[model samples]
Target chain A: MKEQDDKQIIIHVDNLVKKFGDFEANKDLCFDVYKGEIFGFLGANGAGKTTAIKILSGLSSPTSGIVEVAGFDVYKNADDIKRNIGYMSQKFSLYEDLTVKENIRFYGGIYGMRAKLIKERTHELLSRLEMTDYADKLIAEIPLGWKQKLAFSVAVLHRPKIVFLDEPTGGVDPITRRQFWDLIYEAVEDGITVFVTTHYMDEAEYCHRVSIMVDGRIAALDTPDGLKQQYGAGSMNDVFLKLARA
Target chain B: MNRFFAFVKKEFLHIFRDYRTMIILFGMPIAQLLIFGFVISNEIRDAHIAILDHSKDEHTQKITEKLVSSGYFILSDELKNENEIDACFRAGNAKLALVFEPGFGRLLEKTGKANLQIIADASDPNSAEMLSNYTQAIISAYIKDLNMAGYGNKIIRAETRMQFNPGLKGVFMFVPGTMALILMLISAMMTSITIAREKETGTMEVLLISPLRPIQIILGKVAPYLLLSFINAIVILALGFFVFGLPIRGSLILLLAESMLFILMALSLGILISTVAKSQQVAMFISMFALLLPTMLLSGFIFPIENMPVILQYLSAIMPPRWFIVIIKNIMLKGTGFLFVWKETLILTLMAIAFVVVSVKKFKLRLE
Candidate 1:
């Protein structure tokens, strides 16, 4: 039970400071993503969500921080973090030239999946998502909704403990976005912690817990209901607008 | 092994699907070879020449016939006098004027010597020099033949046989050089563009975020080009032998192994370029200027590296294509064995190792 409980703190970011030259992008920021929860990290365009995500993704080194993901430190155990986490970007980041199955296999292959398992998982995945019909189609030929689902599935195909989604629903239709949230909910239900950064307040409401970044620090961090009730607002959208304007 | 094969299969599918890549890889190199071979030449043929004969004797008439038959010079006009030489040149009707001094046959018979002053246009020195040299050599040979026929007692003799490339076809030189260039372009430039394209389309991030090892990602990206360049090497060799009449005088296995080594070196260079480049455009620009330009210009493909300035010569020496050109030329044109080409092979092997090391280091740094 203790071993499994240790997995609860899937990601624990401490007093993280990221700087580009003299400018501090993420300063004295701290947050934690519990296991099996959809945690929304929200910020405006320049509010430093990307910089923090970059540091966590092992794409860039943090200026100073104790960044941990999937029970491994970001600085020292990056290889472990790599194995333990998956990322989906704002771009529906599947290989357009590749067929849906090939993209899944490619992603799975990268994570060192066995050929048999990759093939098996691909079959299971396509059938589950009802993407079996589009499995042989090139990613470009598929509809946008299917591409979005494929990108999300590919990100988590390796069965990582946590998935980092950097605006995974950008340019996606509202119907697909809602469907996308259902997929996230399904992953979380399977004990895969979801750490997502988004500009959408409605999406923020769907997250079990949400943190809003304003100017480089976490301005608000709580449940959607807790934040709205505390801020005397009826919705997450109003709470965000009031805080952003402030 | 299966994973590697699967990765290679995916790479081939990517290449086969992209029509532009198929054209650039299979279509361009052969076209380039044929275009440069049959369409262009360094040998000057039928260059304009004006004749000035003081004595229009049988000897001079026979000499003109030999010169005309040699195809080195076209007799543009008969020069009336020495004064007309300048006018003929000024009128741009001739690039060279031959002046046969007065008493040409008389002097040759009595004094055993005759002067043929060839005043050639010095603007393009190489072609002019070749023209003059051909004229002199042909005239000397004709005189020698005349002497052997008992017309004269001069015993100066010369015999020549063109060794490997008897017909002296341009394809003999260009075949190996084109193979070097095309393989390098496909392996280095095209591979970099493909890798950099993943970064451009935002797919690289997703792949990296997945469970795929960085090594597998790189191997997957480069494997297709490796197979392609190898097949291209074979195609060029077959075309050179069957179509263009070039021969492989040395061990075929050694040539193929060395060609494969050179391809690896080029692909490593492509990987190195992709590491520094942020997007496909940057990758392509770097591959063109940093790899393709050096591979083509510095490798002695079109220009002799020996004739370049000392610094450029040294720079060219470091280029893998330079070593590859020497190796392939030795194998194909010179028909030299492995003993002769092992040093070049070693150089290419070391270069491939160095490129892979630097690129892997850069890739690690980028991830950091």
Candidate 2:
């Protein structure tokens, strides 16, 4: 993994709370993601990880909190934050009926990228993924692994400052998951911050820092080694169990 | 503008590449037009009938001849008695039976009133109702002719004149109504489904996370549908004019302008539906039950609104297509100008604005 010692904070959240009626989906959340660092948002099912990500990405609003993304207020400057961030959802986000090139071009164009730049990036992305032959192929014809990778590439086509990946490797093989992480490492190398959510502990260990949510609050927030040492556990899975059990 | 076009192009790809959507968007209107124009018409011609005459007198014979010669009915058989009436109907040889009462001519001469029983097969109530109506009209005309023969004074003659549609062609009624239905389905249902599909596949989140404004996203999604539905309206009008000889008696430009207005209204309705639906299936169900069925049933498309119960008539007044069909009929059939249809146009404009405002508000709420 590339070193992320710049210490420039990109995302700042303080005491964020989101409630639906009487039920709180996220409660008293506080975290910060640094410049060019891979911040893993780890949680079990219904752990409010998705809810926190939504608030940070400007997809939803918090009931009460101070949340800043890419140096802009989530409440007042959501559009500016949107322009500076990329999002790849857990569900496949590409138009399955559209060709791979069309999908990339559409995302690039919507981000106000010039036509010439979109063409250049299209060439570079397809070549980087070794998918030059599959540019004209419909997304539905591609394998799930390549599709997720392509989705990630499309998400970052405009080179946003930060990218949010919500469970980008949910149902992929081990090799593909590793390859997806390699892409994240490459993006981080380019000084693009990554805020990703996952339940995979092996993937959690790859992050510079991790925050594990239990119920609707962040139960633990630290580096993987720090968390494991603090809990006297061998792996992130056990650390999560020890924290969650407590 | 470039981003908007790019988004719209993506939408077009989603539409044209999917054969199911293509069939529904293009093929359904033509099929509905052909079916409604030729097969499911209300103009009765050569309907089968059985006659049971207890009085073989001149008056009863004259009435039967008048009914058959009016070209609305053909005598399939002559029944012997009341028992044969049910047999004739059960055999499906006739949809209607005319029974002349005993001493019908004598009763008419003495009391100036005669009795005849017309029994219609009521299984399919709409057709049965039409059959009974046509039979009554024919019998009434015969009675009028009999009075004109100087046997008695003619009582209260009504010189009814049917303007525009002198032949009362069923095509005239269906063309306007079908246009309303087709435009609403293509604009509202298709746009809603496309948007809901994006939501289903999670591309909607990607969209919301983009720099494009929510209004831009919505307009981008519906712009292609607007163009295609406009083309569909023109095609339906051309077919109605050329194939069925339906007329555009008013200004063609005004007709098109009104159609565009209705399409806008329907697209706004689509946006509203998409706001409430989270999945493609749910969107489709809501569109079908909420928009499509109401546009068809309560829009005065096939049924006469004035003849419906007063409560339903009041309900139909709020149906957007009801006003749209009336405006289209006035422009295409009645040859009326803007003065006659301005109220309908204003109503449709208000509805379009209302839908757009509601959907935009709901969409902003969704984003928050």
Candidate 3:
């Protein structure tokens, strides 16, 4: 990546702390995501990755922190932040009962898009995903890989400045994951910042920069090669194992 | 307006797409109405009775004939002595037994009084009570006829006028009650289950993150049910009027306005229930137990609340359908104007507002 001065910080989180009663889920978390970068958030189960992401997505409030997403404060300007960002949850975000085109139009319409723009984007997105033939079919009848791709496309349909994907490729085959990464890269190429959380070690390697959270704190943050070099590991998986073991 | 319409359209689609739910939503009201109208009745018809006539006289025979011809009692058997009364009831051959004193006719002629006893099978208390009432009415009418024909003298006579429902048709008693039940079931049960279904399927999370306000989400979920329940109320009222001859004594506009108020109250109750339930099954269970049972039992639907124990009568006051049933019966049967029902309307309005406020509070808490 270029030097930090060349890129603008899109998501700025500083000293983020989230507590549920007395249990601190996120402790003194700090990170900055630059514009047009694929920032990977990596962690094991119960490592506070989701808690921090939820705060950034304006889904939850932090106990004590300064978080800014899409140039809006997390506390007072959540609605403005929500208007500028997109979210695709882990649980198959689109309605399975609705047809593909209907799902796209619904999400777009809820975002306050005009009818003409939604219709035009519906046509463009279906053709670009090469899913034109399956446009009228219910999401339940579509293949898993195709649904995943469509879900990503729908998430970005409103042209939000940044899109947050929480474990977007869990349980997919490796070839589909690769194709899914191709979609992510395509989204990144359009100058859309992609913030994603994943368990896949190899997927972590594909991020421009990755943050590894261990026990509610960022244990390591660096590029893939830099992380591997610092840990004297041969691959991202070995580097993750080293940090997770520590 | 467009987004709200789109959301409501999606809700309607969900309702129509599932044939099973559609059938339940539309079928249950009619089924309950038919069951209450025809299968279950409080009026007595052709009850069996046995006669124990100790006096072999014309006066006793005349009383027996009058009771038999009234179409309320069938003379199933004859009892020679008092001992056979137990056998009649034990064998289930008679629901009541009429006994005459040994010298019935001679005593009435000479002393102006004769003993006539009625023995009713009290095991099924309802039918037993009805049978006894029918017997008393028939005897009183016979006495009045005798006096009128100048054969006897009477001191006083009490005439009863059954005003609204002179015939006491069971349909008149149940129409308002059934309207309350149907509206409560459709508005409260269906809305809670629908909202809970959205939560269970994870679509609620998607909607929450969207630009639509939380109140809009709730209103969108409840609007279709409100319309549907209103339609059901109209269908029930139409059937009650055209098919069952049930009358609406008051202004039709006031009845409809009151009905809409009750529907809003029920819809808000549904929203409150949905906020408490995390899953569809839980929502259904809550509506069934918390809403449906109380509505049917405590609403004075099948039973009169005045006759209930003091605690239950107080409990009935808290049930929304109880007040609704009162308002409907007065307006539809008595033809009372809004001036008579304003108190009930006001109570329902306060309840609706309270439910909506609590639901909004709960929803905001959930977001936090």
Candidate 4:
């Protein structure tokens, strides 16, 4: 929404390269995510989207790159970077046996939040998500939509500077995915930057900016409308197809 | 520290909520102790035997009465002839048959010689050998009594004494072995599976991405198991003491300290396994095959290490439970102090350190 020069950059990646043994999972990737914006990372399976997200999240070390998150270097200040970010994967990260309230409390406690703050925030979160009635219910008792939303909420419970979502809405219905994006918009409104990776083309349109990776390289990156206009396509899907064909 | 406690608390919740884990943590130690103590024992009690006494004299009746009343044998049947001895054993009604061949008390008084044959089933060779040894010991005692009464010139006699455990109670050996086995199972297997569960469910990624360090996560995962395993060890020791009459002849503190050390070693080994295992099933498999089987077979828990083949003996030298069993036996049965068991303790200590070092080295800080 704002000019790139005026906005603050929360994540900065320059010539990031990652290799595993003789295979390169990511190659010469370059990108930046501004604070308080939804950045979509789009790629088909094995395009190395997850690998790049892992490196940016401090979950994996880049073989060679200048990657920074929340102004912390990926190589040296990984722990600091970890403290400033949150993560959720497609595999429903909530402890199934733990109640919703307990999961929230546990995540908050591990993030070193004060007991009083965690308690207050848990109450606020349960009500805000309209899950106050389900606070004492185990995560297994909740529906898939609620579980995804709860996972996203827990990821941002510490008010992290950036939350990484690795296919957070993989199997959810379109209606629920729309609701999940609403939550993401709410998080951005609260000044939390979101970096999400997905294969859903329609989800790409909702992002303030998007990067399409192909064969371990970023082939295209721009705002959804800007990419459509540049590629002379009607939708992000056609733009992706054009790039793939190229 | 607060975060660590929170993580440990969550681990405890996981263990307590899972009934299977609850059964394993509490039920296994007691069940194993009772099974090893009451069942699967070497000591015999109330063994049935058939007596064929041709003499029908006072000495023969007295010896039969002595064997029955010694609490080792029961007079199950009176055989009519030598032919019935075979039938009694074939029917599985008797484990041994005692035959006295046309022995008159007058023969012993005049010539100082009597013929008595003790036929054992020998199908169960160990028990058969034991029954024969017991019968021989009682007969020899009777002969010695006769000599003491000046019935004849002195006769040659062999005496054997069982030291430490004079009763030869099988529980003595099993108590230490079971303690080692249960501690290893709970500490190593449970911890590994729990860690693998995190990886399988993808919670590990979230935890890794959090402010918690990898060391903190590992310690948090292991802390509750350590406490639970220590409690399990105490329960086994208590059962051994009160139920089986196994003595803590040495310093209980030293014994418990050694147990704690063994527990540390098992916990570290568990962490190492988790580092390699990608799923809960793989972790469980590795724990069962790599830990449980070896502890049962190679640690001299059920089999003697000395009786093993040359290579297995060498292999057992690296088994942590083997050294632990030795240390426990030395303290519990031999009543030895730290000075006597320092070598075994040092070995266990070194193993614990090595496992911990290797685990930390193998534990991935990044999700490679």
Candidate 5:
């Protein structure tokens, strides 16, 4: 329950390679994510962060590598991995027709949450997001920022060991983005591992540890300050541009 | 199983929550049935006809009166001359015209013969053909009646009445078939498209990553549509029975059980389609192409499969509609017991099982 007490290795990947025919979307990728920490997995588009995250989330298979998340083998224990991990894609996957409560209840049902518990938790989730009044409102009526936050909350509603947020802050307002990070901070405080990918350099500075991918490979992996100092850059964006150019 | 139920619940929410899909799945069936059943019957209804009786004799009067009272034709006008027949028809005054030669009543007494000409406008061939056929029947009946009166020994009688549909109304045939086709397309095609839509939009990935098993997810997604389609089937059947006077002379229990079986088969097809397509558009195109046209053309619902080409007949044998239509005809028209329909039921059950099995396998492969 204490801060940094759940600092266990939540994700462990070694030499992970995801190849489609002759093209390798993720080649020889390696990383480790610690519990109770927001780990930034940054890369330009097509730099294999998505493929690696998919493999880690048990959504896809690695070509020939050892990938483990929460001690469940990516290939052998996929269902176990799916059970232990939650994913919120960049697309904000939520049923548009169903009400906010219905969406939560349906996803909760997927997580095998008991009806009474889903009810209690759904109520708590709405109140926590200040979305209690809108529980009856269909998701289509909600703003994109609130929907994004709701999607993230619902993703981790069952309290998975690790949560994967694939560009969860795309196109959101600056104030809402800040609020979204606060929600992520709260999740991290509860000892949940947060694996997030984003183009926002300011958000990367908030991560405990960060890895920048370049050209289907992990180009650099270190703390924010160390990355900035090593790359001799003013910010993570400069570090990225420098690394991407070199 | 639990996960599938949840996904099915989600599916139901998606289906019921969207008014468009509800209208398509449910509204279309009842609308199609009513349109096909009540509106589009080939039976003549208060059809107007002009009579060109040049002689104005007692026999022509009696026959024309009989024709008007037959309920199939209404005498719109009594023309004075043959020239008026074509002009009245050209003016669209009547679909048919009856012209009797001079002295029709006197000819029966003298030579026991008379010339009665039934002239119908050929512009619309369907009504013309039907008019000619009915006119021929009325003339034959009159001759037979005259013979019976003259000879007093009624050798042969023709007191013909159409069985099931006493008026031989075409709506009686269309209602059941329309319901079957609409339900099949909506339940199977729309559900499949919705399922495939989730996959395309990356929402399926979100569900797959959850604690829910793949089967649970699919079952959950399809469950609501199944229930909705069932409700649709009931509404249409009720409308057909109550509104259109279409009878279900067979066991109601058997008909319901058969309908449920058909719903399952159609839902399985939706599942199969979802597995094949990755987007709503592709799923829709496939469902429209695969189910709708085939259900209409090859099902023996409108066009008899027996009259189709040998290759088409063989193709129809594999169509679920063909079996469904047979079952409906047996129940609605023949009023037969379940024993007679067991073979078609077995085929539908097998098709349902095959689709469910194939969809399950395809779904599993996607997970793998």
Candidate 6:
């Protein structure tokens, strides 16, 4: 593993807490995500994984924390944080009625991109995704896996410093999930940090660093193999089971 | 500004691509206007009546001839005596019964007074009232003619003239009412549903995380609807003028300006509703019950406000469309200027400001 001092830190969270009335959704969370790395946030259903991602993406305010995203404070510089981040929700977020190119143009326009740049990027993205023929087809006509791939591409279109994905591969087939991870690897290669949350244990093995959240708290966080060896488990599934059961 | 325009363009595309939305936006106004104009009417025509000529004198015969020739009464049944009047009414053959007293012409000459009774079916009170009024007018006109022909010297008369609507056409009333209803539905309901649709589909999450401000999102969502609703207002006005012959007696510019104000008010109201509603279905339900029903019932659109109960009248005073309808009636029917409707205009302006303020305050800057 690379030494932490040499790598650049993209996100810094210290004692983050989120509460909904009397219920604590996130409690005294602290972690650091390095630049150009796939940092996985893993948890079972209602383990507050989505809530943490939301707070980090500038979609929700942390109750109290020294959270910084892309070197900007989450409290004072939310709009700045927003400008440097791209987010893909767990639900499908593209307009289904719009053609793929139109959807691309809309997102580009809202992000304040120039028209000529949006046009050129549209061509490059379609060709890169091998979706040149389907560019003119409505998103509703495309298959789910293709739609998911297209959504991820759109999220990183502006080359945001960090891209937050909330269970992006949910309900996708295994082959497509593998292909989707390849796309994530390509994004990482472009020097964009990937912050992804997922409940899939096997996918956890792919992350450079993984954080396991249970009952609104991070139970254990480390490299997948380190976590497995530390738990004396054979696989990430067994590691997760031991942590959750404990 | 460019980003705002792009957002607005996308909204327009959504409206145009959805066939159901297109139909509701354009088709509803014309259909509602035609239905209100042609189907639901107050003016009586070709009403059946039974005439009981007890005297059989020349005067009674002449009066009966005049009543039949007036074109309102169709003379469906000719009754022989008083007993047949009940049978004629119960059989549903006639809506009115006209009776002349014995020696009608001789009694008129000797005592200078004669009694004629007009009996109308009161089950349907509105038409019955209309039928009675028509009969009274015809009889009065006949009396005036008789006095001119040296039949009577002195007779008191009450001359009534209907102002604004000389003929009392129902279309005149419905045009303004329908305009208010259509504008409220299109502006408020459409905007709310569109915004709530973003929330339901999860696109709002991405938008909230983006650099776009909340105000920009709201303005972009409502801009397309505002323009489209204005066009709808013009279409309703044009249809009223060309097809129904409803007059625009006041300044056309003033009328359109008032319409724009009402549209703005409704759009803000829609934004307010969307702030509370988490889904399109809930937004639609709130708009239908809260906006559409109140605009129809309490705005003095179909029912007269004076006739409603005191509490309901108080309730109507707070409704936005009530002021709008009054302003429209003043401008279109009464030929009044801005001076006449400034109070209502001020009320609508205040309402628009209040809704915008409340919605802005309630609109969450971050997802909770």
Residue-level lDDT tens digits of model 1 in A1-246: 124356467788999999878999998999887888888999899999988887888778898979988888888888888888889888668888988988888777767788889899899889989988888899989888888888888888878888889998988889999999999988887788888999988898898888999998899999899899989998899999889999
Docking class of 1: medium
lDDT tens readout by residue for model 5, B1-368 = 66567777677667666788878876787778878876777888778899887678777887888778888888898898888988898899998988778876777567666677888888879878988777777766876776767744332445566777877788777877887798789888877887888887789889777877776766776777777788887898888888878888888888888888998899888899989998899999998999989988999887887789999999999999889888988987789988999999999999999998998998877764
TM-score of each: 0.88, 0.90, 0.94, 0.98, 0.92, 0.97
Fnat per candidate, as a fraction, reads: 0.57, 0.90, 0.33, 0.83, 0.80, 0.82
- What DockQ do you compute for every candidate structure? 0.50, 0.76, 0.54, 0.84, 0.64, 0.81
On residues B21-63, what C-alpha lDDT tens digit does candidate 6 reach at each position? 9999999999999999988978867889999987888878888
Which 10 consecutive residues of model 6 chain B have the lowest summed lDDT?
B151-160
The i-RMS of candidate 5 is: 1.7
lDDT of 5 at B284: 91
lDDT of 4 by residue, B1-368 (tens): 88987898899889898999999999988998899899988898999999998898888988899899899999999998999999999999999999987865667777888788999999999999999999998888888888988897644666778899998899998889889998998899998999999999999988888888889999999999999998988899999999999999999999989999999999999998899999999999999999889999999998999999999999999999999999999999999999998999999999989988888877774455
C-alpha positional error of residue B344 in candidate 1 after TM-score superposition, expressed in Å: 3.6
The regions of model 4 sitting more than 4 angstroms off are B153-155
Steric overlap count per candidate: 4, 0, 2, 0, 7, 0
**lDDT score of residue A91 within candidate 5:** 84
TM-score between candidate 6 and the true structure: 0.97
In candidate 5, list every pair of residues with a backbone clash: B3-B216, B4-B216, B4-B220, B7-B220, B7-B221, B8-B220, B8-B221
What is the per-residue lDDT of model 6 for residues A1-246, given as tens digits with 9 covering 90 to 100?
Answer: 368778898999999999989999999999999988999999999999999999999888888988999999988999899889998977998999999999999888888889999999999999988999999999999999999999999999889999999999999999999999999999999999999999999899999999999999999999998999999999999999998999
Worst 10 residues of 5 chain A by lDDT: A1-10
lDDT on C-alpha atoms for all candidate structures = 0.83, 0.91, 0.88, 0.92, 0.84, 0.92
Ranking by DockQ: 4, 6, 2, 5, 3, 1
- Model 3 lDDT tens row, B1-368: 66677677778877876787788778988888888888786777788999999996988999999999988889999998888999889999999999999999888777777789999999999888878877887887877887888867742344556688877788888888888988887899899999998888777877777667888899999998888888889889998999889998899999999999999999999999999999989998998998788887888898889889999999998999998998999999999989898999999999999999999999888876
Task: List ranges where model 3 is wrong by over 4 Å.
Answer: B53-65, B78-84, B101-111, B154-160
Interface RMSDs of all predictions? 2.4, 0.8, 1.5, 1.0, 1.7, 1.1
Runs in model 6 deviating more than 4 A are: B365-368
Please, what are the lDDT tens digits per residue for candidate 3 over residues A106-220? 8887788888999999999999989999988989999988898998999899888999988989889999999999989998998899999988999998999999989999999
